[model samples]
Target: MFRSLLIANRGEIACRIIRTARQLGIRTIAVYSDADANARFVRLADEAWRLGPAPARDSYLRAELILDIARQSGAEAIHPGYGFLSENAEFAQACADAGVVFVGPPPSAIAAMGSKSAAKQLMERAQVPLVPGYHGDEQDADFLHRQADQIDYPVLIKASAGGGGKGMRIVERSADFPDALASCRREASASFGDDRVLIERYLQKPRHIEIQVFADSQGHTVYLFERDCSVQRRHQKVLEEAPAPGMSAERRRDMGEAACAAARAVGYVGAGTVEFIAEPDGRFYFMEMNTRLQVEHPVTEMITGQDLVAWQLRVAAGEPLPLSQEALGIHGHAIEARIYAEDPDRDFLPATGQLVYLRPPAESDSVRVDTGVQQGDAITPYYDPMIAKLIVWGQDRAQALARLDSALADYRVLGVTTNIAFLRRLAAHPSFAQADLDTGLIARHHAELLPPASAQPALPALLAAACWQLTGEARHTAHPGWRLNAEWQRTLHLGYHGHPLAVRVTHHADGRWTLTLPDNSQHVLSAERHASQLTVHLAGQRLHADCLQHNDALHIYLPEGLSVFTLPNPYAAEADAQHGDTHLKAPMPGRVVALLAPLGEPVEKGAPLMILEAMKMEHTLVAPGPGHVAAFYFAVGEQVSEGSDLLDFVLP
Candidate 1:
């Protein structure tokens, strides 16, 4: 066992690696950028170093700086957690050259599987089942289009040099092939500095199942079962679970054997995932192999009772495999939900801001939270917006899902918008609960999955009113006799998210207050006053609202967000309503990757007009019209602020 190791990554994965390393009596060193100076992972490590400024290129992605830190800290090994430099072959070789072990696959395996095109060729040569596609070396535009034609329509164009749904696009027809290919190449070049892309026949109703395999320096490799990651949006996984819901014993063995074969072909070691795209009819095709630890490794850990990180450490220390293929056992079911700093209601736009309050559900006997952030930490736009991975284990899939739903509801994160509410809805979705999932699940149930703004609950205004009215009258005043002692002294009017809410408060002799909502329902509330905040309780819900009194208006804090309220006024009229508005604005702060719609071009209601790249994926801004484009407010490559105009058009 190694005495000390350095984690060449940041955020939750870094924190996760440190936890296991410490448990094995290994001291851990953490590297951080300027933006993450006070991050949770930094505090968790036994030693820490500043890599560089906030930009990833200057910090987390700098292989030279990371290698230097590991050498200076006298660390025996460097663990490159997923993302950033984890799959970078050059970084792995650099660590080896510097006499430091990289706790992952050998550099030779990474080089072979690092490029999608190269991996496809290798897999085909090794007799592994591969998806039928064009893996040719020719990058000519016409030649690629010819290959797409040969493969027929509905082909997937993916960046050969990158993963993570970054440089990937699906074209449904030959008419859209040319443009989609150009866009994919441009993004691939910008993201990975490689403009090469490959075309493949798109599989319909595909379930993403991956096998977790581990090997040791002694050339012993074994498969540890599989995980189903079929729940996705924009080709990115949202939820994952181990021991696929209905996988037969035969199918499991076949897939596991194939995965192990692929690993042996590349001389793979440590923890890695071999992903496959399985059709509805049970036929599975190799997608690609992740050369490092995955974000959802916890699910595999729960089912197999294995510490994958610990395995990596042992393997890196030149140890032989402790167990064989027949020795591994999997029990029960486990599921993981990726909680991100995004707004599902707003087309799943990435949100950036300070985290006011992040209260993840406390871990219980079966519940776990792997997080890289703390309360008051800022979510910047420089990297992935994933906040944490919420994982749960149970005796079966049903129990795991039930626990996940409950955990999601109990989670409370404020300051910036998140997908907590959205995840809660997804777990309860009928299709999802039934395990009938695919890449198009989010699109098929688009209306139900992403409800309009009107679907959001209107409780903020009511809560604001309750808080405003309850705190308006001070218990003590400048004049001693200003206090009033009636059954009920004040009726307060509060607003929540611009909605009016009327609340009446009755203070009892015991100091607890009773509040009546606009609907005439009454509930008891407890108050705990502080210098900056006022705590209130109703039913089983407790809220800590910050008090800000300005211009006779009081603001109340609700779980959804904060809202302001004013004094009761019967004469204040409501504004006129217009519901059929169109011409979408920027959902959040992002850069325009391209302008798909030309000036004065007529478009359908759901036509793609432009693409906004934010947080990591490409979001196609659609036209909610059957009218001609009135104007284009921004051009390609332009950075726009949140709510900045992208297009202006009148609906037909």
Candidate 2:
């Protein structure tokens, strides 16, 4: 359609747009911040432009800079890949004024539907079913409390300009409304620049179902079914699937019709999603309309076998709708897991580091991985820490879920912690397998779904580490008789993912080894090394091991996990505390949005200190103890590469 286009985003979505654009012989230009200068998306683009510093405001969110990049790169259009300026009406209007196509809806539609409060009002006038709530602009505390009382208890206070769970709070009792509203407004103001909010009845056990609608300039709109994104943490979706499990044909038709009506009423064009919150009783209501392509569009593409990005470009080029609602059909089930660089064990905190080793699950006909990082790439604190999106498809829901589980298990990432284990556990859980889940399911069964500490499987790894270390030491025995000494024994200290394991390997004269543990369990083992297979015999059981040596340290890969150990060389010096360089840090790598206190300020225990935004969600980092701010390493707009110190405090 167009000669070239600039992608106004980064990460997997930008890479995804590039893939489809290439398929259509369209040259793609990529814009990057300092953090993403070396990102895979930039390398994959036909041309690239440096936006600004790492902070989003100076780069991704700068509409004028993006427009200038498009002009300099000779890009005829701009694709605001979800988030950032994707939903900004002013950005859309700016593109229109610059005579460049904004591959999204009209600015008028974005302005009308961008605000949740305004969208709800317009939906009501368009005869669309809406959740009963207060949408008035009265910000008076008492007036809002009165409105909440009228709507009844268990109401949701949502930011009028928010999406992705920002500035949203749920109040269970009338007494909690005041505090919740205050907190919600503060966060709303900080995140969206809009403190205006609305109140709605909080639906319990709600399943978030949203209909995918695509339209063109011809005023023809078609529905692409729906995606169920109920599996979430803090209102951010973890997993998404299309053709929701147990969805009846009748309900699908009804929701699709309603979504199309909403789009047509606003004269919506291009790819957009109409989100609805469906109650347990099967009743659904219009929540809001996203004015651009969604992050989870791959799940929809997998089932429909249509390239949504290509459609976006074609629509922007003034093409008419290619398929009508009646012709569009979903052929299979698709599930997508948002693989984030986060530590699931530690409250799902976001993590940051150089990706020393990054191995996504092996690709196949039924699976797709949308990623934007490469090995040795650094995940900075200036952006979302989502490493990639894993999409799996199958003939049905059960098969898709199983494939997704296996895919997550095969994923491997090092240098920084990830939620792969957490995702695998959730996908394999019985409740998830049966699709009996909701937004709160993860929190409800958090203990059950958590990676079991007991199931970490370290014995095999310990044995490998011990065997490798002992064999290396025995190879250099000073005395010839020392090699044959039955009493030759040494303690091996091995390091696992991070924790240390003590292993005692005693090599006997008979060319066998006896391993003893702190738990008093003893195993006799024999080792046989081959080019490909390393076998270890323990007692009467024979097991395969993958063992190697790197930098004089023994490395062993077991079925469960990997282990590393140093040889018991008497001359080898003890390891220094320099290894502390890599320690526990903030969750999903993102810029510090706010510092709760001034530098050198004293704070009470549990007081909020800093707020970090990642994966489109904000995480408030609180003081661990009563302390005085020792240092503030981040400014309001400075991009501290993830793990870069946000601040430090001295304990009082």
Candidate 3:
């Protein structure tokens, strides 16, 4: 084992690597940017060093700077944790030149699989099954269009050097191909600095399954079963599981062998994954290869009882394989759900804010949480918006599903929007519970998975918020509801989801209270508060909840879901109603990428006006109605803050 190790990444994966290194008695060194100066991972490491500014290009991707840090810290090895510089072949080769061990595949292997087009050709020679498409180097738009026309409609345009669902598009009709191709190329150039792309037949209703393969310097390779990553949104995985729901023994062996063969073909070493697109009839085709640890590797670890990071370290130390192919076996089923700070109802737009309050489910032998953020950390626009990964294990798939649903219900977050409620609904959906999954599962069941936000707060939420406020006031005042001759009455005005709500509370002499809504409906209720936890008795039922207050906003956490309410301001509401439609503001902090509509020209409703790039994704601003853009406040290639006015629109 190495005496000292340096982690070349940040966030959860960096924290994850530190834990394993500590167990192995290795001194772990962490590198961070200005944005992560006080991050959890920095505090967990034995020593930490600052790289540069918050942007990745200024810090994490600075190969020479990282190598210099490794030399100064006396690190014997460097672990590239999954993103940023994980798959950069030049960085790997630079570490070698600096005389530091790189805990990943050799640079030759990474270079061979760097480009999607070239990798497909290599797999062809290796006799691996491949999807039919154009993998040539023809970059002409007309040439690609002709190729797509020959392959038929409904083809996939994927960036030659892309991963993580970026720089990819699906054209469903002949008329949409040109626009889709242009958008795909733009994203590719922005993300990878390479605009080359290839087109392939888009497989409808296909399940995504990938095999985890490991190799050592002694030419020994083995497979660690497979994970089904079929439930996805926007071509990115949302939920994953091990020992695919209905995989047969014969098919599993065949796919495992094929994955190992692919690894051996490239002289691969350390941890890697070979993805495949499988049909319902048991036929599968090669998709692509990831030359580093996967984000969803926890599910595989739970089923196989192995620490993959430890394996990567041992392999990099020139050790033999831990176990032969015949020695490994699946123990139980495990499922993992990625928790992100985003709004699912608004097309999964990334959100940014301080994590005012955070609570996760209890961890046990069966439940686990992998995260690098604490309660006070902020989810900024400089990087990915992932909060954590929740993993659960059970004796079978049914038990795993039950645990997943229960765990998702117990999660609580505030100050920014989250998709916890949506995940709970997705886990309990009838189709999902029945194991009927595909890449388009979320799109097919969109109505059920993502219901609109409630127009008004639920009665329990309102009552809880009101009681919490009253009890807090009582702590400061001696007799808040004491009256000489009559019961004391108070009214609370709150806003939820843009709707105003007024609740009237009357405290009676018998130590009970009657609460009335705007519609005159009344309910008898009483509550006892201890810190932030509230125990209430309402209408012959007892309920337990958590209420957090920040400034004038109240967050209610219940068994059903989360509700956010703010103190109503009538003047601000009226002003917003008058100007909100005419003033176009940036939904989140990002850089202006393009201007689609011409200024002072009339455009129809739903016309795309501008494109903003944030959190590694593109968001298109559209016309709210038939109008013209009178002026633009920001130019292309300029950064804009959240809620900043970007343009002014005039009604036709």
Candidate 4:
């Protein structure tokens, strides 16, 4: 094994690599950008090196700077953790030229699989089943339009050099193809520096299944079974599971062999994943091969009882295969849910802010949490807003799904919105529990997955927030005659979502208060506070919750969901003007990608105006009401802050 290794990534993957490296008695060096100076991964490293500014291009993607750091730190090998330069073939070749081992496949293999079009062609040659598509080099608009015509409607335009769902567009009709292709190419160029694309026949009701394959320099390769990642949003996976539910043993063997064949064709050495789109009728087509360690590798590790990172390290050190296909076995079912700093409502726009409070499920023999942020860390706009990954294992699919829901219920985060509630709902849904999955599952059950407006915040939170306020202001321990002259009751206003709720609390001599609401609902509740934690007793049941104050809002972490309450400003305020204003502003911080309307174009109520890209997704701003574009403040390709005025319109 090498004496030292450098991790060329950040966030949870970096921290995860360090954990395994330390267990193997290896010293790890971490390279970080300006945004991650005090990050958890940097603090966990044995030695640290500064890369550059916060953006990926200035830091993490700089292959030469990383190579210099590895050489200076005496790291014999470099681990590119799953993003940025993970699949960069030039970086792999650079590592080889510097006499440092790249803990991944050969550069030739990466180059072949880096392009989706090229990978599909290679897989076809290897006899691996492939989806019907066009992979020609001519990227002209007319050529693509004609090819789409031949392929029929409902085709997918994918970036040839894309992964993680960045540059993918699905068109249902012929007319939408041109606009989709333009958006797809723009995203492709911005993300991969390549504007070329490939058109494929989009598969309906298909399940995304990927086989985990490993190879050694000795030409030995083995399959670590398969994972089902059909639960997705925007073509990116939200949840992943190993030993796909209802998969027969015979089909597993066939897919496994095909995966091994693809690996052998590329002369692959190290860990990689061969992904496919499997039809419900059992036919599968090759999608693309990830040339490095995957983000969801832990599910495979949990099911196969093998540390893939360790395999990568040992293989890079010239070691032979750890275990053969016959010796390997799937022990149990495992599930992983990616916790991102995003709101499921409002179209799942990514959120950014500091973590006022965070508490993950306890880790043990069954539950595990892979995280890279501390409680006070900030989720800046510089990178992906992933908070952590929660992994659970059980003896069967039912047990695993049950454990996943339990783990999600116990997870807590505040200040920044998250999708934990959405995940919990999906994990416990009857369809998901029965293993009925597809790429469009979330969109199919949108209304069922999200809580109704009435169920957004439960009634218990109101009592909890009020109790917390009473305790924080030291009113709970007031004099015995507190209510003697106050008409035996006191009313306080608690703001929830900017609306005030008048709570009437009637103090009783028995240390209990009768809480009343606008609905005339009354309950005798008692609360005891110990610092920021509170325990409320209602009737015969007891409940505990955490509360904090930040951003002029009271953040309450409840079992149902995170609730925010604020004491609205009474002396300083203005009447809302959004109802009549004609100015268009950005809802979030992002870069203006394109402007559709000219300065004097009359747009309909819902006509597309401009597009803003943020946190790896594109959001289009449309005309709120019927209006004519009067002026534009920011042009395309300029970075704009949240709430910045982008356009002013004249009401029609």
lDDT of 3 by residue, 1-652 (tens): 9999999999999999999999999999999999999999999999999999999889988989999999999999999998788888999999998899999999999988888998999999888988889988989999999999999979999999898888999998878888888888888887777889999999989999999999999999999999999999988899999989999999999999999998999999999999999998999998899999999999999999999999999999999989999999999999999999999988899999999888899999899999989999999999989999999999999999989988888887877888888899999899889999889999999998988777765565455555555555322223454588689877776678777777777878877788787778787787877777877788788888887777667777787777777776557878788776788999999999889889999999999999999976888999999999999999999999999999998886
lDDT of each: 0.82, 0.81, 0.89, 0.87
For each candidate, what TM-score against the reference?
A: 0.85, 0.86, 0.97, 0.95
Highest-TM-score candidate: 3
Models ranked on TM-score:
3, 4, 2, 1
* Lowest lDDT block of 10, candidate 4: 473-482
State residue 385's C-alpha deviation in candidate 2, in Å.
0.3
lDDT of 2 by residue, 129-225 (tens): 8888998777898999999999998999999988777789989999989878977887787667788999999888889999999999988988999
User: What would the TM-score be for candidate 4 when compared with the true structure?
Assistant: 0.95
**Span of ten consecutive residues with least summed lDDT in model 1:** 474-483
Please say which candidate is ahead in TM-score: 3 or 4: 3
Give per-residue CA lDDT, model 4, range 474-565, as digits (tens): 23233435554343666656667656666676777787788787667787788887766778888888878776666556666676655676
Cα displacement (angstroms), candidate 1, residue 224, comes to 0.9
| Model 2 CA deviation exceeding 4 Å by range | 174-179, 455-482, 485-487, 494-500, 508-512, 526-617, 621-652
**Cα lDDT of model 1 by residue, 1-652, tens digit:** 9999999899999999999999999999999999999999999999899999987778988899889888899999999999888988999999999999999999999988888889999999988888889987899989999999999979999999878788899999999888888888877876777889989999988999999999898889899899999988877899999989889999999999999999999999888899999999999999899999999999999998888888889999999776788888888999999999997866778899888767788897689999999988989887889899999999988999999987886676666778887887788889999988787887888888766444223354444544444455432222212345645445555444446555566667666667677677777766665644676676787876565454445544444433445554343443112323654678877789888777787888888888887765677878776876678888878887777867876777
